[model samples]
Target chain A: MAYMKDDQRKKLAVDVTRNSKGATKYILITISVLFVFFMLILPLFSVIVNSLKEGLGFYLEAISTEYVLAALGVTILATVITVIVNTFFGIVASWALTKFTFKGKQFIATLIDIPFSISPVIAGLAYIMTFGRSGWAKPVVDWINDMLGTDIKIVFAIPGVVLATIFVTFPFISRELIPVLNAQGTDEEEAAALMGAKGWTIFKRITFPHIKWALVYGVILCTARALGEFGAVNALSKTRGETFTLPLEIDALYLAGSADSITASFAVSSILVIIAVIVLILRNIFEHKSKANREV
Target chain B: MAKARKFRGGRVIPGFGLTFGITIAMLSILILIPLASVLFQSFRLSPSEFWGIISMPNVKHAFATSIGCAFIAAVINSIFGIMLAWVLVRYEFPCKRIMDGVIELPFCLPTAVAGITLSKMYSTKGEIGGPLFDWFGLRISYTHVGLVIALIFIGIPFVVRAIQPVLEKLDSQYEEAAYILGASRRKTFFKVIIPELRPALLTGFGLAFARGIGEYGSVIYISGNNEKEHTQVVSYIIMQKLNYLEYESATAIALIMLIISFILLLFINIIQIRQSRRTNNI
Candidate 1:
C-alpha cells in the first residue's frame, strides 16, 4: 500500500473513479442497445425469416393463390381511394384553417384530431350504428332503394369498407398539412392575391411548390395506414373473400387453424413489413429534407 | 372591433366560401356524423339499460384489464423511452440512424402484423419465450404480461420521439453549471435535466397511455382473449358484441371508450399548447 508516491496515489484514486463511471456508462448503453435488439429488431427479423423458411416454391405458391391476389387487389383499391379523398380534404381544410380567420377555428382544428384518439374498433362500431341494418341510415337506404329500384348496400359492403377506411384515416393528411401551412403563413399567399392572381393560379405558382413535399409525405402516411386498416374494415367486411383487405386476409389466415394457413399468414405479414420499411425510409428522407429547408 | 373584423373579407385568398364549405361538409360526413351516431345510439337505451350493460362483471373486467395494461405499458415506456432518448442525444453509436428509423416501425407497420409476429415470437414454444420459460418458468404469451408487452411495443416510439427533440434542444449550460457547482452527475440529471423534461415526459406519457387504451389489433392475438381471465380488452369486447348482433351493448362500450379518449386528447392538446407557448416565449 505504501509503494506509491503521494501524487501518484492521488492520480490512481482519480483513475479508479473515472473508470467506474465509464463502466456504468458502458453498462447503460449496452442495456439500451440490447433492449432495442430484443424488443424491436428480433421479432421483425424472425417474421421475415419465417416467411422464407419454406423453399421458394412454397413461398411463391402461398403468395400467388387466388385468395391472396384478391386481397392484394382490395388493399390497393382501398389505399388509392383513401389517398385521393383524404389528400383533397387535407388541402382544403388546411387552407381554410391557415389562410382564413373564422369563428370556432380552434374548435375545428380539435375536431379534425378526433379520429386519431378514437379506437379503430370504436370507429367501426360508430359506422355500424350509423349505417348498419339497425342504423340511422336505414331511412336513407330505403329512400334510395325505393327511388332507384335498386338495393344499394352501405354497411357490410365495399362502400362500408371504404367509408370506414376514410373515417379512420381522415385526420392524417390534414394533421400533417396544418403545421406546415401554419408555419409558412399568409405572407406569400397574401402577396400573390394582391397581384390579381386567382386562387388556383396562386396555389399553383406559390403554395403548391412549398407544400408539395409535405403533401406527398402526408399522402404516403395515409396510404400506409389505409392499407393496414383492420378493425374498421373487419366490422364492415362480414363476407370473408368478398370484403377482405390484405391485413384482414392475414388475420383470417392466422385464425384458420391450419399449418398452411399459418405459414401463409407469415408470408402476408412479410409483405406488410416490407411496405412498412419503405414507408419508414420515405419518412426519414422527408424529415431530413424538411429539417434542411427549415434551417434555410 | 371584433364585429368589424368579422364583417371584413374573411380571407386574403379567394375560395374562403367554397373551401370552407367543402371542408366542413367533408368533416361532417366523414368524422362528426359517424362518431356522433355511436353516442346517439347509446342514448337509445333507457338509463337503466345503460347501467345494465356497463355494470356487467365481464364489462368491468375488460375495462380494468384494458386500462390497467395500457397504464403499465405506458409507465414502462416512459422510463425506458427516457433512457433511449438520452442515449440517442448524448452519445454517438454505430447504426444510430437505423435505430432511429426503426423506432417508428410501430407507427407504420400494420397493427395486425405486429400482433401476429409478436404472438409467434413470444408463444411458450417460440424463440424468446421458449428459453424464458425453460430458464425462469415465465409464460408471457396468452397472459397479461404478453398483452402489456404488445402495448409497450407500440407505445415506445411515442415516448422516444416525444423526448428526443426536447433533449436535443436542451441547453448544455445548465448541466455544466451544475457540474461546476460540485453536484454529482446523478444529482444534476435528476435536478437539472428532468425538470426541464417534465412537459415532454408528461405529453409522451399521456399520448402513450391514450394509444395503449385504444389499441386493438396488436393486443388481440397476444392477449389470449380470455374473458374469464380478465384479459379481454374493451375494443375486443366491442367487436365480440357486434358479432353477436348486440348493437346496443356495443354502442354503449364504444361510447365509454370515446369519452375516455376525448378526455385524454383534450389533456394532450392542452399540454401541446402550453409547450408551444413556452417555445415561442423562449
Candidate 2:
C-alpha cells in the first residue's frame, strides 16, 4: 500500500511538470507575439491607415507630386549606380581575399567593414569635408571640372549623395560573398589554372555559378539600403527636389508641420513601404536559395 | 614566418594582382580618403578647443541621453530577444515563417518611414498612446520615453538575429542532463541554458547598443528635438552643427563618436574570436 502511494505521487509530479511546461510555452509565445505586434507590426499597419486617412484620391495626389517623383528618380539612380560599382568591387575584393593568401588581408577585410560601424552622418560629413569648399580635395575636384569645361559639384550635389550611399553599403556584397567563397576553397581554381584555363574563363564557369545567388542576395540588400539612405544623404543633400532621396523627401514632408503634409508624408512613405515589402520578400527568397546552395 | 611568406607567394590564382589592385584603389577612394578627411579636419583644432566643443553642457546632455537610452534599450532587447529566439527555434507555431520574415522589416524599411509611423502611433492622440496616457498619465511621444521606444524598435532585429543561430545549434542533451539531475525547469534554464547562450546574448547586446548609439532618423521624429537637454541625441547635435555650418565642431563631435564605435567594434570582435576558439576546442 505504501509503494502504491509513492507511485501515485511520482505520476502526479510528472503531470504537474508537464502542465507547467505547457504553460511556460504558451506564455512565452504570447509575450513574443505581443512584443512584435506592438513594436513592429502595429506601427507599420498605421502607416497604411494614416496614408489613407483622407481618401484614396488624396493618397494618390500626395504620392504624385513632382518633388516625390524626382526624389524617387534620385533614389533609384543612386541605388543602381551603387549596386553596379559595389558589385564590381565586391567580386574583385572577395576574389583577391579568398582565392589567394597575401599580407594585410585581414586588415583589408576590416577596412571594408569600417562603414558598417561608422555613423551615416559622419560618412556624409566626411565627404563634405573632403570635397566641400576649403577641403583638401577641393583643388582636385576643381581641376577635373576645369579640364572637362563642365561645372560639376561634388559635396552638395548628386555625386555626394551617390558617394555617401556607396560608403554606407560598401561592405554588404563582399561580406556576403566572403564566407561562401572561403568555404569554396581554391582547389578547383588551382586545378583549372594548372590546365591553362584563364582566370576569367574559370570564374565564369565555376566561381560565378557558385556565388550567383549570394551576389543577388547582396545586391538586393545594397539596393534596399541605398534606396532608403537618409542620414548620410541628408548631411550632403541640402536642396529638396534637387538632391533629396525618398527618405529625405519623407522627412521634409513630415516636418512641414501641416496636417495635410503629414498625411502626404505618410502617403509618400507608403511607396517606400511597398518597395521595402518587395525587397523583404526577395531577400527571404534569396536567403533561402543561398542557404540551399550552401547545403548542397 | 618564413614558411608563411613562401605559402603566400605560392598562390596559384592568376588575377591576384589585378583583383588586389582594383580592391585597394576603390577602398582608398571610397573609404580611406573620406574617413581621413574627418580625422584631418578635427586635427586642425587644438586639444582644448576640441574639448570645449564636445564638453558643452548641451553636448554632454545629448551624449548622456543617447548612451543611456541605447544601453537601456539594448538590455530590454536582450531579454525579449532571448525569448523570441527560443520560441522561433524550439517551438512549432502557425505563421512562424511569416513572423520570421517580419523581423527584417526594420532592416529593410526606410528609417524615415519607421520614424514617422512610430511617432504617430505613440503620439498622445494615437492608438496605443491614447489609452496609455489616459490610464496611467504617461506620455511617450516627444519625450525621452519616446526615444527609448524608437530605439527598441530599431534594435529588435539585431538581438534576435544574433541569438537565433546559436540557440538553434545548442545541444539539448545538456538541458536534459540538468533536468534529469533533479533540477527544476527554472534552475535548468538559468544554470545550464543561459550560460551556453551568454556569448550570443552579449553579441546581440553589443550590436543593438552600437546601432542604437548611432541611430538618427528613427529617433529624431519622436525625440521632440526641441528639448536640447532631454531628447537631443549626439547624431542630432552633429546635424545641428552642420545646419549652422559649424563644420569643425561637427567633425570634432564625430571624431569622439568614431572612437567609441571603434572600441565597441573591437570588443565585439574579441568576443567573437573567443567564442570561436571555445567552440573549436570543444
Candidate 3:
C-alpha cells in the first residue's frame, strides 16, 4: 500500500512539472499589468514632469502674457455656459426619459449616441456648413448684423465653440442619469406619490438622491471633455491666437517650434488629472455603496 | 417582471410618452441635424467631381494611409487590450489599484496633450524617440509609423475599458471546471474564456478602429501631416480644403468618411444582434 501511494504521488509530481502551464499564465498576466502601468502613467508622467521643467522656461515665458490670460478666460467662460446649458437640458431630457414613454423612444437613445460615435472634426464641419459663410445660420446672422451692426461670427467665435462643446458632451449627463434611474426602480417614487407628493416634491426628496452621484459623474466628465476639446475648435478656425484655449494654445506653441510650452500644457493638464482621480474615487465609492445596499 | 411588462404603467417607472418626446428632440438637435447637414452640403458636388477628388494622388494616398494605419493600430491595441483586461480581472497583486488608475489615463487626458508629448518624445532628439532613432532608425515622427503609434495610444483604452466590464461579469467556474478535468490553462482559456469574449473583443476593436479613423489631434502632432504621402490623413485634407475656402470639396471628402463609418457601424451592429441571440440560446 505504501509503495502504491508513493508511485501515485511521484506520478502526480511529474504531471505537474510536465504541464508547464502555470508559469506561462503568470508571465502573460505580468506582461499585461506592466503594459497598462506604463502606457497610462508614461505620457502623464511626461506632462507633469515636463511642466515644471526648467529646460524650456524661455518659450513658456513668451506665452505666459495677457494673451494666454484671455484664452484662459475664454475657456472658462465657454465651459461655464456649456455646463449650465447642458445641465438644464440634460436634466429635463433625463427626467422626461424617466417619466414618460412615447413614439421613437429607442430612436432617440440611438441618436444621442451619434455625437459620441462620429468624429468631432465632422461635427465642426457640420456647424460650419450649417452656420458658416453661406450656411443656414447666415440669414439670421445677416439680420442680426444688419440690425445691430455687430459682427457675430458664430462659426469661429466663442458662441460656436460653446455650441460645439455642447454637441460633443450632450450625451454624458443623460447617459449617466438614465442608467441610475432605471436601476433604482420606481418603488420610492411611487411611495412618495402615494403620500401625496407632487412632481417637484417627489423629484427633490426621492428621485434626486438616486441619481445625484451619477449626475456628478456625468458633469465632471463633461467639464473635462469641454475644457480640453480640440478637433472641432481647430477645424473651425483659429484665426487669432488671442482666442486660443489652453489646448489650442499648446497646439500653437508646438506649431511655433517652441518646446517649453509643453510643460505649461502639462501644468494645466495636471489639474485635469487631479479632477479625474477624484471623480474615479467617487465612482468607486458610489458603486460600492450601491452594491452593499443591494445585498442588504 | 418581464421586458414588456416592465413598461406597463407602473406609475413609478415614469411614462414612456414623455421620455420618447424629449429624447427624440434632444437627439435630432444634437446628432441628426449635424450629420445630415454634412450630407446635404455634399449633394452640391457632382459625382464626377467627387470621383475626381478621390482620384487625386495626395487625397488617394491620405485615404489609404489613414485606413491602413488605423487598421494596424486597432489590431495592435486589441491584442494588448485583451491581455490587459484579463490580467486586471484575474489577478490580485500589489499596486492593482494604481494599475487600474493608469489604464484610465488616456480617457482623462486631452488628445492634444497626448499628441504633443508623443511627438516630442519620439523626435530624433526627444527623450524616448532619440535613443530609438539612434539605435534602430525607427523614426516615428513625420511618417506613417508616427500616425500608427498615435492611433494606438488613443485607441487602446476603448478596447480595454469595453472588455474589462465583460471580463468582470464572467464567471470563473468555467476555468475552474477545465482545471479540474486536467485541461491545460491555455486550452481552457482559448476554448472557454476566449469564445465568450469574442463579441466584446470585436466590438472594442471596431470602436477603437472608428476612433482611429476620426483621429486628428494626436496624429497632427506626430505625423508631419505634409501633403506628400508622409502623414497626411483625410481629416487633414478636409481641413486644408476648408482653410482654402473650398467648402464643396471639403464636404465631399467628409461625406465619404461618414459613409465608411456608417457601414462599419452597421456591420458591428449586426454582429452584436447575432451575438445576443446566440447567448440567449445558450
Candidate 4:
C-alpha cells in the first residue's frame, strides 16, 4: 500500500461540506452567539455597571463598612480552612481510590459524590441536626461546655459556617484529582518504591510534579466554592453580622429594603464577580495546560 | 476476609493502608456522619408523622414547583446549551476564549449574588424587566418565570461543559458522508449528530435538573417565598422548617429531596457507565 504524508492525510480528512460554509451554519452560529450574549453577557454587564454606577466612593463605602469587612474576613478564613482540609482529603482519597484496588472502592467514590447531589441548604440543616442547640449531640456539647466552663457556639457561629462550607465544597478537589490520578496510574510511584525511595520521597519526587497543576486547579475550584457558598451558610448563619459571610451579608443587605442597602448589595456582588472573573481566568489557563499535557 | 483481601490489586507503592485509613476516616467523619444524621432524624419520627410532613399541601406544592420548574429550565438549557457549545467549538470568532470563560461565571459566582442580580434586572421597575412589565404587564420578579430564569442561569454552564468536549472531538467526516449519500443537512444532523450527542445531552439534562432541584441561594430571593402560592421550593421549605425548630420535618423533606437527587445522580452514573462501555467497545 502507498503511504500518505502528514499534510496530505490532514487535507483528505478535512470535510468539504463542513468547510463549504452553508447558510444553516451561519444562522445557527448567530442564534448561539445571540443567546450567549443575552443570557450570560448582558446580566454580567448589568451587575458590573450597576455596582460601579454609584461611583467609586459609594462602592468603596459600601464594602468598607464594619459588617462588610467582617464578612470578608470570615469568607477568607472559611476559604483557607476549606482549601487546607479538602486538599489533604483530596490527595489521600484520590490516592486510595486510584492507586489501591480495595473492596467498596466504587461505593466510596459514590459516597464522595453525595455532597454534590444534596442541596447545600439541606447540608446546613444536617449540621444543625447534629450540632445545633437542640441537636442529637446536645447533651455531649453541653457536657463539654460545662467541663470547659466556656461557651462555644457551633451552629450559629464560625465553626458551623466553616463546617457547612466544607461540606458543600468537599467534592471539588477530590473530583478534580481522581480522574487525573487514575489516568496517571502508579507505574512511576512503584518504580520509585522499587528503587528504595521512601513513600514521601517517591511522592515528592514523582507524583507531586505530575499532579501539581491539577492540585492547584482543584484548590482554586475549592476556594471558589468556599467563597461563594450560600445556602448552607445561610441556613446555619444567624445573620447577626457576627456570623455573616459575604454572601450572607449580600442577602441581608438586599433584603433590607433601603436605597442604600440595595446599592450596597450590588457593591458586594461586584466583589464576588471580580473573584469569579479571576477564577475563570485561572481555570482557562489550567484547562489549556491540562489539555496540552493530555495531547502530549 | 479472603475475598476482601483479593480485591486489592498488586501495587508496589507504599502507604496503601495509610491512604486508605485517612480516606475512610475523613469520609466517615466529614460526609457520612452529617448525611446520616438527616436519615437518622427522619427515622426518629413515626411513619405517620413522616407521612404527614411530606403529604402536606404546602410540602407537596413546594416539591412540585421545584421539580416542575427545574425540568422546564433543564429542557431550555439543553437546547441553548447545545447551540452555545456548537458555536464555541465550530466557529472561529473574536473573544471566543472570553465567551467560554464567562459561561462558567455562574459556577463560581455566589448564587446569592446571581439571585440579587437577576432580581434587580427583572424587577418591576428595573432595567430589563421594567420595560418587560410596562409594555406587556409581565411581572417576572417574584414569579415562577423568574425562578426558572435563575435556574436556567445556573444550569446553562453544566450543559455547555458537558456537550462542548463531545462536539469538539466529533469527526466531521461522518456528516460529510451523510451529505454525500444524499441526506439533507437537517436529516444528517438529527439522525447522525443527535445520536452521538444524546448521552451527553441526557447527562447534562440530569445534572442541571439535579442542581436546579437542590438550588436554594439564587431562587430564594426571587421566589417571593409566598405562602399564598407554590412559589416556595423544597429547599426553602426545609430552611423554613428548620427556622421554626421543626427538625424532624426538615429532615423528612431533606431526606426526600436527597432520595430524588440520588436517583437523578444514579441515572447520570448509569449513562456515564454506558458511555464508557460504548467507548471501550469502539
What would the per-residue lDDT of candidate 4 be over residues A1-296, giving only the tens digit for each residue? 03755444335434443556577677877887787777777777788888887789999999999999999999999889999999999998888888766678877887888888789998899889888765777788788999999887889899899999999998888888887887787777877888899988987888877777788888888898899999999888886568899999998898998888888889998888888889989998997887666555
- lDDT of all predictions: 0.86, 0.88, 0.73, 0.86
- List residue ranges in candidate 2 displaced over 4 A: A1-20, B1-9
Model 2's C-alpha root-mean-square deviation from the true structure amounts to 5.5
What CA RMSD would you report for each candidate? 6.6, 5.5, 6.0, 2.9
DockQ of 4: 0.61
| Residue lDDT tens for model 4, B98-215 | 8888888788888998898888889898788999999999999898999999999989999999999887766666776787898876798799888999999999999999999999
What does DockQ come to for candidate 2? 0.55
Q: Distance from true position, residue B258, model 1, in Å? A: 0.6
Off by over 4 Å in 4: A1-17, A145-150, B1-10, B171-173
What value does the TM-score of chain B take for model 2? 0.94
Best-fitting candidate, measured by DockQ?
A: 4
Give per-residue CA lDDT, model 3, range A156-264, as digits (tens): 8887887787887778788778767766766677667777877778788877877776777677767877887888777765755555676777677566665445555
Residue A51 of candidate 3: its Cα lDDT? 67
Q: Which 10 consecutive positions of candidate 1 chain B have the poorest summed lDDT?
A: B1-10
What tens-digit string does per-residue lDDT give for candidate 2 at A106-225? Answer: 778878888877678989999999999868999998999899998889988999999999998999999999989987878888789889999999899989988999999999988888
Query: How many clashes (backbone N, Cα, C below 3 Å) per candidate?
Result: 0, 0, 11, 0
Q: Candidate 1 — which residues are off by over 4 angstroms?
A: A1-25, B1-10
| Candidate 4: Cα lDDT at A119 | 91
Docking class of 1: medium
